[model samples]
Target: MPTILVADDDANIRELVCLFLRNDGFDTVEAKDGKEALTVYTSVHIDLVVLDIMMPNMDGWALCKELRKRSPDLPLLMLTARGETWEKVKGFELGTDDYLTKPFDPLELTVRVKSLLKRYKMAFTQTIQFGSITLDRKTYKVLCGANSLVLPLKEFELLYKLSGTPGQVFTREQLIDQIWGMDYAGDDRTIDVHIKRLRERFVGTPDFCIETVRGLGYRLEIMS
Candidate 1:
């Protein structure tokens, strides 16, 4: 089960959030302040953080900055009583994945948490494995038994996006737009080149392979 840290100065609010998350099949750790949140953060492999903005000891903005420094991709959702537009803007500026104003329905909170975890699977989550292949997304490294390789930026992102949703074909245009950006002036062949490199790097491994979807696109296939 995934672990989550709930940080809020209000003990009641923290416990309530944890209870709802627990009911949603998640293990939750609680912290009453930003300082405690940081301490608890290191003690567990927290999948996501649901924290309030106005925390004691340290505010959410400060802690969010600190957390980003430690793990740039960690999914963070802010819970705060302040519903002002500027406050939400500041939270986003601080790199929060989602922000829920105070008095939010518990259902929405759960939905946001689930969304963040799903979206950031390659970032803060543990190593992803498909058969003998092991990928540490945080470090952009791939390991297959004794063989290992460090991928280039584009190659790493290509692999990550493909593996993100296994067996789902991503069209060449879609890959270019999403990975290379819509402003990319390069031809569609740019994606093919990156895919080719990924295949070459993992060619010797039987654990996973990129399959050509014939006239359509490509998909990451993990073999049995």
Candidate 2:
């Protein structure tokens, strides 16, 4: 199930959003302010974040900026009553993936969340192959020729991201954005950990290498 973080000062707004998300089969964690939101986000694994512009302590923009610094590709949905062009631009500039005005339709919010989840989930699949190893994106199964390799969720996502593009080199930011979704609330350390795990899994496979580009990022080396 997808996890969502809803940050709003109003009790009613938080409840309403939580209800809608729950009905849509999403698990949510709620926060009343930006500080609380950041706390919840850092601790829990959230797929997306719904941030309100006006809030005490941190505010949406500041929090969004912090999130972007850690995970540039993290998915964030900015919520505000302003609805002005500049406010929207600021959110976008701060790395919010989407935006919604206050008093938004519950159905529309549901649809947006569903869409984001679908797009993010597509990054990981149960069936993928990098050289001799084959990954089942759905079942999280990894097969190396006749041998099957076990992978955790993070490892699976990393391999899936790399395998999808074949030889394409993806920056750590790109990988974090693709696999962890936008509102990841995690840092580059998250990407490093997953990459380490993935490399160890394919260590014996001389053909498949997750190449490090120094300052660029990592990529699956495709041998011809």
Each prediction's TM-score versus the true structure = 0.57, 0.55
TM-score of model 2 (CA atoms): 0.55
lDDT tens digits, residue span 128-208, model 1:
777777778778788878778888888888887777656555677767877788799979898888888888877777778
Which segments of model 2 are wrong by more than 4 Å?
122-224
Error of 2 at 224 (Å): 36
Which 10 residues in a row give candidate 1 its minimum summed lDDT?
118-127
What is the per-residue lDDT of model 2 for residues 107-185, given as tens digits with 9 covering 90 to 100? Answer: 8998887765654554454465555777787778888889877787878778777766554456666667667876788
The local lDDT score (0 to 100) that residue 71 gets in candidate 1 is 85
Residue 61 in model 1: shift from native, Å?
Answer: 0.6
